[model samples]
Target: MLKQFGCTKFATGEDFDTGELFVQFEHRGRMVSLIASSKGYAAAWLKENPYNNRRKGTKADHEAKALEKGGTAVYSILRDWVKGQVTAIEIGMLSFESAFLSHILLPSGKRVIEHVEEQKLLEGK
Candidate 1:
């Protein structure tokens, strides 16, 4: 049964030190909670790589190196999350990203996403 559901905006922007996004619900007479994006999840990532000099000095030198690091970071985070048995996730600013990443770490992609908003803003009101 559903008990609680909602996503809160970061109090101090992306400074994970402030807070995080998550959801809660009741399952089998117990409340299951999930916490996500509790830290600067994307700050260190998407940046330059300290290793792999060859990834640079190419056509997209700068961009390629950065993207490679991003991919590796994503893999690491996903793997860690799986090991920790976290029940929720937030990534790449999209629902599919969460589902796809979770699938890689969770069986059957056995994940469920519920998005809720008080007032969704749309173009032209």
Candidate 2:
């Protein structure tokens, strides 16, 4: 997966470790690490930092209401996939702007993520 995104050498440039999914490579002499995570993980994070039910009197409040929802958990998951520069297996109808946000340099891909922890091994279980 890392190689798919031009991340040939490990960030640490050492042998792989199972406990962590971080991979790094130099991009113009700067090190960038791609943190791979599962949809479940992002969903758990969303569940942890829930929006406080405050007065809906501000624009931030309205934005939170729309962005911070149970359904957006899937968005958070896909965002991480984009962050990691994962390959695009399928892209049904997602918009290009939505797929590659300004924060992520890699384009987004179609993934069916359902767990906080990946059940498949790096070699693909």
Where is model 1 more than 4 Å wrong at Cα? 1-59, 86-114, 117-125
Report the Cα lDDT for residue 123, model 1. Answer: 27
Among these predictions, the greatest lDDT belongs to 2
Candidate 1, residues 1-125, lDDT tens digits: the string is 12122323212112224434444333333333344552334335433333355554654565545555444554455446443433343333344234333222123222322221123333254
Clashes of each: 0, 4
Q: How would you encode candidate 2's per-residue C-alpha lDDT over 1-125 as one tens digit per residue?
A: 44554544544321223212333454333344434433334356546654456644564664445444523444344446655443342243554334333322332321223121244433444
The Cα local distance difference test for each model comes to 0.37, 0.40
Error of 1 at 58 (Å): 4.6
Model 1 vs. true fold: TM: 0.30
TM-scores, all candidates, are 0.30, 0.22
